[model samples]
Target: MGIEPKNLAGWSDLLEQAVKDTLIPSMKTQEYTWDTTDIVSDPKRLAAFVALSSAGESIQVGFSGEPSDVASVVSQMFGFDDLEDAGDDYSEILDGLAEIINIVAGALHRSLSSDGNNLQLSIPLLIHGEIVIQGKEEWVAHRLTIGDNNIDAIIIRGLIQKQKD
Candidate 1:
C-alpha cells in the first residue's frame, strides 16, 4: 500500500501550504500550476539521474529553467550553502533539485498521514531528457496555476503495489 485517496487530498493541501510557506516567500512565484502526467517517457531526465542510486519510485515535477537556477533559489530559501557545479557531474545539481522535491513531498505526507507520521521518500531524482507527457484512458490530465510559474507534480499512489506485482 502506498498513499491513499484521502491521504492524497491531505498531500495536496500540504503542498499548497509548502508553496506559501517556503517557495512563495523565497521567490516571486508567478502563475503556478499543479498537474500530473504519466512518466511514460521520462519527461525530465535530470530527476531520474539523481534517483538512480536510490532505487525508489519517482514522481516528476517540472519547474522553470536549468538546474543552476532552481538550485540557487532553493539553496537560498533553505538557508543552505550555494550549490556549485564542479565539472559536468550532474549528480550534484540533481541533488539540489531532489532536496526541493523532498521538502515539498515530505511536507505533504506529514500533513496527510495519521498522527503526523512521516512518509518515506526516495532520494530526489532529476530528469533532464525530453519527456512526453500523456494521459491514459483511465487517467485524465489535471492542472493548477500559481503565480507566473507552472508547477507540475505527479502522484504515484499505488507505485509500491504496482512494483510488487
Candidate 2:
C-alpha cells in the first residue's frame, strides 16, 4: 500500500530546513519567501534541476536554477566560495544538489508515512533544460536568494488512489 501524507505545512517546514541545513552557512542568504513563481514558464528555465520521487510517486519534489545559480548554492553547500560560471565544475555541482534532494526526500518520506509504511526515497534525478512538475493542485512553492542567484523549490503532490490488494 502507498503511504499517506499529512498536512503539507509540516512537509514544507522540513524542506525549508533541508535547504538551510544543506546549503546555508556557506553563502549569504539574502531572503526567503513562499511565492508562486512560474519557473517552468520563465525564460531562464532554471538551467538545471533535480527531482525526487515520493513513495509511489504521488508526490514530487524539485529544485532548479541556472548553472551560475546552481554553482552559487552548491559551492556554498560544499564550503567553497561562490565562483563564476567560467570556473565552476558542472558535474560536481549537480551531484551535490542531487545529494541534497535525496536528503530532503528522505525527510519528507519519513514524516509523511505516519502509518509506518516503510516508504522509500527514490534516487535523485538530475536534469538539464525546461521541465514541469506534475500535480500542481497540491503545490506549494518557495523561493530563496543567495547573493544574486535565485532558485525554485517546488513540491507537486496529489491524492493517490488506493492500491488493490
Best candidate, TM-score-wise? Answer: 2
User: Stretches of candidate 2 above 4 Å error?
Assistant: 6-10, 42-57, 81-83, 86-89, 110-117, 133-138, 158-165
Error of 2 at 51 (Å): 6.7
Please tell me which predicted candidate would have the highest lDDT against the true structure: 2
RMSD of 2: 6.6
Flag clash pairs in model 2.
46-65
Question: Cα lDDT for residue 116, model 1?
Answer: 42
User: What would the per-residue lDDT of candidate 1 be over residues 1-165, giving only the tens digit for each residue?
Assistant: 333333445544555675555565665454455565333333233332111012233333233234455555555556667454443555666666667666666555555456443345556545665433333312222243444333344443322111110
Candidates in order, TM-scores: namely: 0.51, 0.68
Worst 10 residues of 1 by lDDT: 48-57
lDDT tens readout by residue for model 2, 18-91: 66665555566635555556644433333332333434555557777777777767776677764445453567
Cα RMSD of all models vs. native, in order, equals 7.1, 6.6
Name model 1 segments beyond 4 Å from true.
6-11, 28-45, 48-69, 78-89, 115-118, 130-151, 158-165
lDDT of 1: 0.44
